[model samples]
Target: MHEVSICEALLDQLTSLAAQQGWPRLRRVWVRLGLLSGVVPDALEFAFAAMATGTPAEGAELLLENEPGHFDCAVCGELELERMDFTCPQCGGALQLLRAGRDLWLSGVEPMPS
Candidate 1:
């Protein structure tokens, strides 16, 4: 799955950051996931566990924060919180997804001395 690749990328980034900062070990990893990011939390977690094998982040916890999807209505000038459909209820206009929930960001990393 793509989540495995994503996890690999994250590990790479973490390794680079740790090397750059001269950290001893990684403690935790904070990630922000969007509702429409097309990523399953369970799958990501599984991938993390599998990919972290024999790595610095083997014992690190992956903390995920989920963000909802939102859209803007052009006709009513209203911001709509969308879960499924992206149709404006007020003006019946097509809603534009202002914030596409497809972000995979490494928010923070905690390191501890070995």
Candidate 2:
């Protein structure tokens, strides 16, 4: 799945970062996952565990933070959620999608001492 490729890319980045910082190992990898992102958390986790084997980040914990989707309604003057077709609930006007939840990134990492 795409998560496997995502994991591969992530490990590659981590390896480069670890080498640059002289970090012995990674204790945790914190990432923020957008709700609209099609990547599955469980699948990503599994991929990370499998891909990290034998690497410095082998035993590292992959933590995910989920973000929700949001839309802005011009008539409402603020962001809204829980509406289908992206139409304003009050004014029936078309709503603008502010966040589509497409994000996969590393937010933080705990590096083990050398």
Q: Candidate 1, which ten residues in sequence have the lowest lDDT sum?
A: 77-86
Name the regions of candidate 2 deviating beyond 4 angstroms: 73-77, 80-96
Per-residue alpha-carbon lDDT of model 2 for 1-114, expressed as tens digits? Answer: 899988988899899998998887999999877766778899999999989997778999999987656777876866646323478767888887886667678889999765
lDDT of 1 by residue, 6-101 (tens): 898989988889888888678899998876777778999999988887777888899987765677787777474636457887777888777757
Whole-model lDDT for model 1 versus the true structure? 0.80
In terms of TM-score, the best-performing candidate is 2
Q: What is the alpha-carbon lDDT of model 2 when measured against the actual structure?
A: 0.82
Model 1 residue 52 lDDT score: 84
Clashing pairs in 2: none
Quick one: RMSD of model 1?
3.2
